[model samples]
Target: MDEKIVFKPIGYIKSPFEDVKNMPKSTRESMDVEAEMIINEEYLESMSSMEVGEEYMVLFHFHKSEGFKQRVPFMGNGPIKGLFSTHAPNRPNPIGVSTIRITEINGNVIKFNGVDMLNGTPVLDIKDIL
Candidate 1:
């Protein structure tokens, strides 16, 4: 039998954008956007050695975006294309990645900028952007 897939969220993201529709299409467009991630206790030690001014690739789960379609309408255009061709949230797995600069790190919270994710997103992991 095929093995079951599983994941444990290491943190949860906090962002200003509550509605996905209000968020800019990409993080590049939201230059001044900021977000905070509350790392779970189990993962706090993993971030104990991180430094400010460094960039990290944050992997997260899209907790709110539901359902997936093989084809979707794009940019208000007429032709429908495969969902893989675009950044639409509908996917077999709704994981997300965003690179952001680390600004501050408290006991269990890490603050960063260059945000595109909606509030309360589950953070799967973080890695150096290099």
Candidate 2:
């Protein structure tokens, strides 16, 4: 039988971006944006080996996105296409992944840049990418 897998959020992400419409479509060259991750107390120990100026892959869930359509209009374009092909927030799982630059680290909060998620988003995991 296939094994079952379960997961829980390790923390929550905070950002000035309160709405999806206000966020940019991409974070490639956007350096002015900023965000923070308020990690849970239980996961504090795991951060000991981490350091400043390192990058991490933040996996999070878009809790506010309720439903999804198979085909969505692309950036107000003409026809609808598969949701997976676009970065639309509406999805079956609504999981978002973004690589951000670590600006600073407090006791349980991490400040970073290149944020595409809205405030209050639950962070599933944080992995060192560099």
Candidate 3:
């Protein structure tokens, strides 16, 4: 059977990485790269319960990635591995998740770190890690 699922973005990211090539290679590299998640006005209430200093998983879409291969080099140039084994952006669903700690919340904007996604990435959802 074939089915379709649709999702609406609750927000978008504001990060220094305007291009994928300029993004950090790993989470360790992006830990200090501050970013912001600007929640849409309609979703502003969703942030009411989120607290600064708490960590949450941010699910987003890789808007620029177009396709994927089952097997590919690790980190662009390494031993080949299955797509599910690596963190490549190109995938069957082009969805991404990153864990970030909330540093500040002003209105509907959340300032955080641990960003590894490109600027303007559409945020699908946010969830508490616990």
- Best candidate (score: lDDT): 3
Q: Give all candidates' CA lDDT scores.
A: 0.83, 0.82, 0.90
The sequence of per-residue lDDT tens digits that candidate 1 reaches over residues 79-116 is: 78888776667677898788888888998999888888
CA error at residue 76 for candidate 3, angstroms: 2.6
lDDT of 3 by residue, 9-33 (tens): 9999999998887898666688787
Candidate with maximal TM-score = 3
TM-score of each: 0.86, 0.83, 0.94
Clashes of each: 0, 0, 0
CA-only RMSD, every prediction: 2.3, 2.7, 1.2
Q: Please give the distance, in angstroms, between residue 43's alpha carbon in candidate 2 and its true position after superposition.
A: 0.3
lDDT of 3: 0.90
Q: Give lDDT for model 1.
A: 0.83
Model 1: ten consecutive residues of lowest lDDT: 72-81
Give per-residue lDDT, candidate 3, residue 38: 93
lDDT (tens digit, per residue) of candidate 2 on 1-130: 5776566999998888888777766566445687899999999999887777887888989789889998998743547888878777788778888888888999999999888888899999988995
